[model samples]
Target: MRIIFAGTPAFAVPSLRAAHAHGEVAAVYTQPDRPAGRGRGLQASPVKLEAVARGIPVLQPESLRRRSAQQALRDLAPDLMIVVAYGLILPQAVLDIPQYGCWNVHASLLPRWRGAAPIQRAIEAGDAETGVCLMQMEAGLDTGPVLLARATPIGAGETGGQLHDRLAELGAAVLADGLGLLRAGIRPVARPQPEQGATYAHKLDKAEARLDWSQPADALARKVRAFDPWPVAEAVVAGERLRIHGAVAVEEMHGAEPGTLLRAGREGLDVACGRGVLRLRVIQREGGKAITAADFLNARRDLVRA
Candidate 1:
C-alpha cells in the first residue's frame, strides 16, 4: 500500500516510522519549521527530522485547508493516510482522498480524552489507566470511531513524560496491527464512542503550571508529575523561582502554614500544604540544572521559607 504520513511532534515520530516499515510511504506532511529556544532558530519538527533522515519526501505547508494543498495530497495517489499528533485539522476533502481512508493514532482511548494534551491531562486527572486508540478519521474533534485500542495502567508515581513515551510506543504497535488487519481485507469493527464520560484535554499552558499551595498536597504532587519536563510545577521562594520536579504527599504536619518549609534535609524537604506535607525530592533553581532537594536546600539556604 502507498501511504501518506502526517505528524509533527516527537510523539508522532514512532508511528511515522512504523508506517514506513509497514508500507511504502509516498510522502510526509508536517507543520512548517518554527522558531525555537532562546536563540529563536528555526527548527524542523521531530517527524520532519526523522523523515528527512529516511530520505522520504516532506511537505511543510502552513495549512491544508486550501484547495491547492488538498489537491497536492490527492496527487500522491496514496492508498491510506496515517495521522498521529499532526497538529492540524484535516478538512473533509482531504479525508476523502485516500483509497482506504485516514487512520489516526490518538494518545488516549476515545470519548475519554478527545483533544490535545491527552497524556498530560490523564496524569493530572489522576486516572488509574490510559491507553492508545486507532480511530477512523472524521470531521469532528476526535469523534471518529475506534477500530483498535490497547490498555496500560498508569503507575502511581508515573510522570507525564514517562507516560508519553510509553503511549507513543503503544500507539505505534497498535497502528501497525490495525494496518495489517486492513491490508488483509479484515476490517476491524469500529465502535462508536460513548456519549457519557467524555472529556476534553485542553492544550497545556505555562500559566497553569504555577503551584497553588492552597490545594491538597496529593493534588500538588500530581501537578508536579503532570507538568514534568515542560513548564514544570513552579513556586516562588524568597523571590526566586523554584521548579518542583519530584515530590510526594505525606501526612499532615502541624504548626507551619501552607507553602512554608517545615523541614529540609538529605531525605527530603517537607513543605506544608493545605492538607498534608509535600516532601520535595527533586528541584531546580531558575535556569539551573535539576538537583536533589538536599543540594538545593544546602546551596541556597534562602529558599527555605519557614
Candidate 2:
C-alpha cells in the first residue's frame, strides 16, 4: 500500500519511521521550514530531516486548505495518510482524498487533553494515567473515533521530557499495530469517544512558567515537572530569580509566608508555600547552567543555613 506521512516535530519522527517501514511512503508532508535558533537560520523540521535521509519525497506546504496544495497531495495517489504532530489543520476535502482516509496518532487519549500540548498538560494536571490514541481523522480538532490505544501510568516524578520520549515510542508501536492489521486485510474497530470527560489542552505559553508560591506546593511541583526542558518553572528565591529544573513537594508546616526561603541545606533549598514546602533540587540562575541546589548554595553563602 502506498502511504503518505505528515508530521513536523521530533516527537513525530518515530511514527514517520514506522509508517515508512510499514508501506511505501510515496511522499511526506510537513510545515515549511521556519527561522529558528540564535542565528535565525531556516531549519527543517525533524520529520523532514528524517524523510530526506531516507530518500523519501518531502512536501512543505504552508497550508493544505489551498487548492494547489490539496491538488499536490492528490497527485501522489496515496492509498492512506498518517499524521502525527502535523501542525496544520486538515480540511475535510483533503481528508477525503486518500482511499483509506487519514489516521492521526495523537499523544493523549481521545476526548481528554484533545488539543495542542497534551503531553505537558496531562503532567501539569496531575493525571495518574495518560496514553496515546490512533484516531480516524475528522474535520474537528481531535474529535475523532479512536482506532487503537495504549495506556501507561505516569510516574510520581516523571517530567514532561521523560514522558514525551516514552509516549513517542508508544505512539509508533500503536501505529505499527494498526498497520499490521491493515496489511492483513483487517481494519481496527473505531470507537467513538464518550460525550463526557472531554477537556481541551490549550497550547503552552512561556508566561505560564512563572511559579506562583501562593498555590499549593504539590501544584507548583507538578508545574515544575510539566514545564521542564521548555519554559522551565521560574521563581524568586530570597530575592534571587532562578529557574527551577527539579523540585518536590514537602508536606511540612512552616509559619513563614509563601515564597520565603525556609532553609538551604545539603538536601535542597526549601521554600515555604501556602500549604506545604517546595524543596528545589536543581536550579539555574540567569545566564548560568543548571546546578544542584547544594552547589547553588555554595555560591550564595548567605542562603546556606549553618
Off by over 4 Å in 1: 253-255, 301-306
RMSD of candidate 2 to the true fold?
A: 0.8
Report the lDDT tens digits of candidate 1 across residue range 174-252.
Answer: 9999888877889878898888999999999999999887788999999999999887998864456789899899987
lDDT of 2 by residue, 39-72 (tens): 9999999999999999999999888989999999
Per-prediction count of colliding residue pairs?
Answer: 0, 0
- C-alpha-based local distance difference test score of model 1: 0.90
**Residue 24 Cα positional deviation in candidate 2, in Å, after optimal superposition:** 0.4
Give TM per candidate. Answer: 0.96, 0.99
Q: Scored by CA lDDT, what does every candidate get? A: 0.90, 0.94
